[model samples]
Target: MTSSTPQTLYRKIWDQHVVTTRDDGTALLWVDRHYAHEGSFHAFDQLAASGRKVRRPDLTVGVADHYVPTRDRAKGSAEPEIREMIRLLDANTAGSGIRLFGLDDPDQGIVHVVGPEQGLTQPGLLIVCGDSHTSTHGAFGCLAFGIGASEVAHVLATQTLWQKPAKTLRITVDGSLGPGVTAKDLILAIIAEVGADGAAGHVIEYAGSAITELSMEARMTVCNMSIEAGGRAGMIAPDETTIGWLKGRPAVPQGQAWDAAVAQWQTLKTDAGAEFDREVRIDGASIAPTVTWGVSPEHAEPVTGTVPDPAQAGDPGRAAAWEAALDYMGLAAGQALSDIRIDRVFIGSCTNARIEDLRSAARVLDGRTTVIPTMIVPGSSAVKRQAEDEGLDRVFTASGAEWLESGCSMCAATNGDMVPPGERCASTTNRNFRGRQGPGSRTHLMSPAMAAAAAVTGHITDVRRLGDVR
Candidate 1:
C-alpha cells in the first residue's frame, strides 16, 4: 500500500529512487551524480587495487579543490601528497572514461560550486560527493549528501548505494529578517538553539516565510551547513528563485527539454498537508549578526553579546567544556564583544564565497579602509572572473582587502595561507574547530558583512552600526 502521510521533498525523491529493499531494512538508492575531489584518492586507490572499473562513467565527475593551491593555479605540479592524489584521479578517470573537470579547465572549481554552476545539480536527483558540504546542491530541491571513502568506492563500483531512510525535520522561520541579518545568521542561530547534534539521522527541510524570501545563494548557505548540524541533508522546495538560477546554465537542458525539466521539478515540492517527523519554528526578526566563540558551530552568539562565563554555566560538564574552550581561545567572560581584536579577516569559503557574497562584501567595503589584513577568495575561477568584470575587485582593493584567486585558500590553511600562532581572525568559513584555519589560530565565525566590518575596525564589531554604504 502507498503511504498517505505528507512527505518532505527529500522523502519524495528518496522514495522515487529506491531500487531495492534489503532484509536489514535499508534501500538501494540510485545516485544520479557522483562528484569526486582530491579527497577521493582513497576510493580511487581501492578501486585500482581491486581491479575494478568505475561502474558508471557518465554519472561521475572529478575536480581538484580541497588540496589544490589557490595561488599557484599555473603550476602543473602540486605538493607530493596532493600531486599523487591528483595523478591518481586523473588516471582513474581516464582509464574509466569518466568526464573530469581538471585544474586547468576554466570550469573547474570547488566540487560543490562547480556541480550547481554546471547544472549537474537538478531537482529530484540523487547527488553525492566526497566532501561534507555536498548538501549545498540540495538548494535545487535535490537529494544530496556526503559519503565516506568506502562508500565512495562502492558507488564508483556500482551506481547505487545502500542506505536507511532518515526521518524528516521541518525548520520553519517566519517573519522578515531585520537589516544586516542574513541566511548565515539564521542558520547559526538554529545551530546554537538545537546544538550540533540536534538533527542527527534526519534530513532537514527548510520552509517558512524567511526561507522563502531568501535568494538561491542564501538558501545554499543555509543548506550547506546541514551536516554540521547533524543532518543527513537539507533542502528547500523549488521555486522561482531556483528556476531563475538554473536557467541558461551550461548543463541545464534547453528548449523542449528545459520545459520538461521544469515541469518535473515543479512536482518536487512537499504535498499539501504533509507531515514531518518533527517540526520547529523560529522568529526571523529576532535573529542578529551571529559569531562563534567556542569550538563548535552550536556555541554561537550575537555579535554584541559577551562571551559565556564558565562559572555561570549550569551543567558541570558543560561548564568544564566552556572553560576549556575559553582557555584555548583566550577569551574572558564579561568582556565586551567589541573589545576582541582580530588580526585577519577572511571573506571566502565553500560556505560563503559565492558571487552574491562577493557583491555584498564589496558594497560594505566601498569607500572604506581596513586596518587588519583582509582577503577575499572567490569560490571558483568563474566567480572570480565575474567579480573582476563587474569591478568588485576594485572595491575590495580600495578597502585594502586582498583579492585572490579561487580555491579553498585560508579556509583550512591546506595551502599555506594561515593565521599565525595566537592570532585571532574573523572568518566566513563554515567550521571553527580547533586548529581549523591554522595551528593555534583562533577563528570567530561571522557573515561576510560582519567579516568586512571587523576588517575595517580591526576588531569584532557590530556590522549593523556601520551605517549605509555611500
Candidate 2:
C-alpha cells in the first residue's frame, strides 16, 4: 500500500507555475508578475544586449522608489544620476507599452506597498523583484523572492525563471498578542529566537491562530522580514482576511470574475498533516515589544530587557562578536535597553509604513512632544494622502516630527536621507546592519510605537512606559 503525499500551499503554488522540469534538478517556472525599480537599469541593459523585448510587459511593472528623493520629488531630482534613472524608467516602460509608476504617479509608492494596493500582488502568483523585500508580496498568498540583476533580465526576456524548489518551514504563533505587542514585535522576537540564518535554504509559511487573526497589513509586515530570517521567501495562505482586502481593489477581478477568483483563493491553504521540512512554534501573547540593539535582525530583544552582556557569551567567538557589536554601537554591556540614547528617529519602511503602523505611532505620541528630531515617511503617496485625510500628519508634525512624502525615505538613506556620523537612531525599518542608514550610523530596529517612544524620550524606550513619560 502506498501512502498519499500531503499537499501544502507552497507545493500547490509551485506546481501551478511549473512550465518544465529538467534532469538537473532545475525547473522553468512561469513568473506571474514582476516589479522593478531604478536598480533594474542593468537588467534592461542586459535585455537590450540580448536584442530581446520584454516577453510580457503586461505582467511587469516599474516604480521609481529606490533613488527618488522622498522630500522634493515634484521639482525633479537635483542629482543627475537620479534624474537619469527616473527618466530611463519612463522611457523604457513607455517604449515597451508597460505601465510605469514614476515619481509623480498617483499610484507611486514603495514598490512592495504599491503592488498589494494596486491588486497586482495576488494569491498563487509567482512574483519577483530586484529588491530583497519582494518577500513582502508573500503576505498576499503568493510566492515572491528577490532575484539578481541577471535573473531580472532573464525573467523580463522570457517571463519565466529557472529555479529549484525550496524546503518548507512553518512557524505557528498562537494566542493573542500582549499589550503593546505588534506584528513587528512578533517578527523581531522570532528572528532573535531563530537567529539570522535559522530559516536559511527554505521558504517560510507563517500560520496559526494569531497569524490568521492578524490584519492583512500586519501579515505583510511579518512576511516582509522573511528574507531577514534567511528564508528564500515567506508566505501566508490567503483566507477571508485576504479576500476581503482584495475584493474592491481596482486591480482585482470584479463581478462574476471576482467571485470566481476568490473561490480559487479560498483553497490556497496547507492541508492538514501536510509535512514540512521544519516547524517552529511561538506564543504570541508572551511576546513583549522587541527592539534590535545590535547589528542584525537576530540581534533583537524585548525593549524591557537589558543590553546583552558579552561576558555571558558562551564561547570566545560569540563573546568577540558581542563585544564588537557593543563597541560599534557605542554601547556598553549590561546597560538597560530603555536607557540607550538616540539622536534621531525614523518611522517609515516597507516593514512598518502602512496606515495601521502610522496610527500606532501616532497613538503613542498623542498630546506628547518629541525630545529629538523625528521623521515620519509614509510608504506611498496614497498612504500620505490617507494620513492627511485622517489628520495624522497634523498630529505627527505638531509633535515635532517631519511629515515627508513617501519613497523608502531614511529606510536605507538611498535618496539623500542620512544619519550623521556617531549618531544613534531608533528606526522602524528592518535591518540594523552597520552603516545601513548612512555612514557611521547606529540603527536600533523597533516597532513604530517603540520608535515614537524613543522620539519622545530621546532614548530607546518601551512604549508601555509612555504613561511614565507622560
Candidate 3:
C-alpha cells in the first residue's frame, strides 16, 4: 500500500511492522514490546532449553501479578507451586537483563496495567503478551494482541512474530452516554448484540463520538474486553485524550522527542473512505448499565431486564446454552436481574481497578455499608497508593469492604483470592465465564459503580436508581 491508499489504523500499524510476507499471506511482523508475568515462565523455559536469549531485552518487561498474593507480600503465595512461578519470573527477567516490577516494587501490578502506566505502550507499535487481555494496550492505537506460549517464545527470541493478518471491523458508537452508564456497560452490551464469537478473525477499531469522548482509562476498559467478543484485538485511534494522558510519563519520550512522537501518533487514524470488512454501529444513548446474567460475557442485559427464558430463544443451540447457563447459575427463568442477590462484591481487575474505577466505587460506598462481604483490590501498587492518598481506601474500608494490595487479584483466579464455591458475586472484572473466579463461583460482571450498588443492596441494582452518581 502507498501513502495515497486509504487505510485503517490497524492496517497502517500492521503495514509498518511487516518484516516480510509469505506466499500464503502470513507476515513476519516486528514486535516493539513484549510483556511477561509469572505465566510467562513456560516461554522463558523454552528459550533456555533452546539456548536462546531475548532479542530485545530493552523492549521487554516483566511484572508479577497473576500469582502474587494480595494479602501477604513478604511471604508471597501460600502454595509452593505459585511461589515458584513468581520466583522464576524474577530470575528469568534478571538473567535476560529485562526490567522487572516484582512484588516489592512500587510499580508492581498487572502486566497490562504496568505497561501503559509506565508509558511503554505507545501508538503505532506492535505489542504482545502471554495473556489474552494484552489487547488492553490497543487502546493507544497500537496493534497489540496475545500470543500462545510457543508464539511468546518466538517473539522473545526473534523480536518478530509470524501472523495471519486479521480483517478489519469498525464498531462505531454514536451519541453521548446517558448518566450513570460506563464503558464497561457499553462493551457488555456490544458483546450481547454481537454474540461471543461474532468478531472471530477480525481486529476491531472502535470509533464515533462516544468512543472518542471516553477517558483513556475508560477506553482501556472497552478494548480490554474485546477478546470476550472473539475479536483478535481492539483499537481506538489516539486523540488528544490519549496523547495528553501519555505525556510526562516516565518511559515516554521527552522534550523535542515528545513533540515528534506526538506528531507521528496524530496520524494513526483511519483515513477517509477507507473500507472495513464489516461495520457495526451502536447508539450510545440506548445502552443501559449492564451486567452478565449467565456464563458468558454475551449473556448480558440491562439490570432492568429479567432472566432470559430458554424457550424464548430463537435457535435451539442458543436455547440449550441458556438452559445450561441458568442451571449452573441456579437461576429461574423470568427472574428480574436486579432481584438476583449476590453473596459478595469484588471491585478490581486490569479492566476496572484503575484510580477512576476506585473513585467511582468509592462514590457509592462513601456513607453506605455493604450487606455482604466485599473485596477491593487495586490494579497496581501505583494505583493502590493513589487511591490511598485520595482516601478512597478509607471509603471502602468504612463501607465494610476489604481494602487489599494490588495485583490481578480475584480477576484471573490464579491467586488465593477467590469467591467461595456456589456463591454469586457482583464483580467489575471483564469475564463472567463459569469457574472463572473459582470452582462453582458464579460471577455477574458489571461496572464498578454497579458493583458498589450491589454491595450496598446485596443484589444487582441499576446505578441510575441510586440517584445521580455522576
Candidate 4:
C-alpha cells in the first residue's frame, strides 16, 4: 500500500475533517454534529463569559436528559438545582439559536439515542458531545466521541476542535451468536477478553460477519460501550444496512442528495489489506450470555461461570480489586453466579432500551410475573409510545415491572431511581461502577433478556434455560 493512500476507515474520516494542523501536531477538526445535554451548561457558560454564541447553531442541539426525572416526571418535579439546570439548557439553547429538546419535547431523550434516531448521525460525520456515550453514534460509520466541557466551549466558539488522531484497532467477531446471546453479551465478552482499557488511545472499528449482519440498533448497543474499553470511539463501515436505516428517518438528506450521499457512503469501508495498528478476533458462537461478576465492565464472564478467586488475579492490583469488589458485592470466591439472588432488575438504558431490546425482554416474560421489583425505562418518549402501540409496555406491566417515562433512570441515581443500598440488581446499563446506581448499590451488568429472567426468578438465571427464545 502507498503511504499516500488512507490506511483505514478512521484515517479516511479524520483526513477529510481536519481543518488545519497545529504546531503541536494536533489538528483543528471540523465537527459535523454537536450534541449536548444539561451537563453542557458549563461550556455554554464559558461561551457566555467570552461574549460568544454557538458558531454553528444549526449543527448543535441541547437536551435535558440526565437531569430530568423518569417517574411521574413533570419538568417541575425535580429539585431546585436540577430544575434550574434543565431551565438553563432551555434558556441557553434559545439564546444561542440552537434547538433544545426540553422535557416536554416529544423528541426529548438521551442525547446518544436521539441523535441516531433523528438521522443526525450519519456516515463520515465528525460528532462530539459532552456525554461519553456519544460514541454510540459511531455505529452509523461516523467518527464520534466525547469531549470535555472545555473542548465543548471551544467547539461552541468555533465549529472545530483541536485533537490528535487516535491509532486504529479492529475487533472482529465471526459467526452467529448462540441462543439467548445478544450484542450486549458479545460486547461484554469482548471486554472480558481485552480488559477494560484494552483499546486505550485507539479508535476501534468493528467488523466480521456477525457484526455487519446485526441490525443497526444492535450495532449501536455494541458501539455505545466502546468507551468502556477505553476506545476513543467505535465504528462500523456504512453499507446497505446503514443506508436503509436512515432512509426514512427524520432530518436525513433527501432526493438526489440522498442518492449522492449513499454513493459516497458505499466507499467508506476499509480498503482491502489496509493496515490497522492492532486487531482482535473472537468466535461469536463461543460467546454465551455474559454478565459482570465484579464492578468493572471487564470483570464479566459467562453466566454459567463461577466468581473469580482473588488469588487467580495474578497481580497485586487486580487481586486487591477483586477482593474489594467481592466484598462490596457480597460475593464469595468460587461462587456460582446463578446462585446469586437479586432484589431488583433494570431493563432499560441507552444500551438496551430500544424497541428491539424491550421486545426481547418482554418475550421472556410472556405469561410470567416478577419475583422482584423490576423497572422499565424507555430510551426515548418515541420508543415509549411505540412500545405501547405494540403492547410491549403491557408485557412489562403485566410481569409486575414498573413502566416509566424516558430518561437515564436506574442507569444513574441522578434522577432518584436509586437501588437500595446493600441490595443487588441486574441492570442493563453500561457501567457497573461502585455506587453507580446509588450509594452502596450493587449492579450486575447483563442483557435485557437476562435482566428479565433474573426479575422473575430473583436470581441470575440464564435466559436460555428458561424456555425457547423468541
Question: Which scores greater on lDDT, model 1 or model 2?
Answer: 2
Candidate 2's residue-wise lDDT over 43-142, tens digit each?
9999999899999999999987877787766787788877888888888888778888899898799999999998989998999999999999999999
Which regions of candidate 3 fall more than 4 Å away from where they truly are?
none
lDDT of 1 by residue, 1-470 (tens): 36777766887899888999988879999999999887788898888899887888899988877766666567744567666766777877877898887777787777787888888898889999887899898888999999999999999999899999898999999998899998888889999988799999999999998999999889989999898899989999999889998999988899999999999999899988888899999999999999999888988999889998988888999899888888888999877787899999998888898998888888789999999899898988888889999999999999898987777778868766788888898999888888988999899988998899899999998888999832
Model 3 / residue 151 / CA error / Å: 0.6
The numbered model that scores best in lDDT is 3
Residue pairs with backbone atoms closer than 3 Å in model 3 (clashes): none
Candidate 2: segments with Cα more than 4 A from true spot: 1-4, 468-470
lDDT of each: 0.87, 0.90, 0.93, 0.90
**Model 4 misplacement above 4 A:** 1-6
Q: Which candidate is the best by TM-score?
A: 3
What is the clash tally of candidate 3?
A: 0
Candidate order (TM-score)? 3, 4, 2, 1
Cα lDDT tens digits for candidate 3, 1-470: 67798999998999899999999999999999999899998899999999998999998889999988989688677899889888899999999999999988989988888899999999999999999999899999999999999999999999999999999899999998999999999999999988889999999999999999999999999999999999999999999999999998899999999999999999999999999999999999999999999999999999899999999999999999999999999999999999998999999998999989999999999999999999999988999999999999899999999999888888889987888899999999988889999989999999999999999999999988887688
Give the CA lDDT, 0 to 100, for residue 454 in model 1.
Answer: 92
Cα deviation at 94, candidate 1, in Å, is 2.3
Clashes of each: 1, 0, 0, 0
* TM-score to native of every candidate shown: 0.97, 0.97, 0.99, 0.98
Instruction: Give the range of the ten consecutive residues with the poorest summed lDDT in model 2.
Output: 1-10
- By summed lDDT, the worst window of 10 consecutive residues in model 3 runs over 69-78
Error of 2 at 323 (Å): 1.6
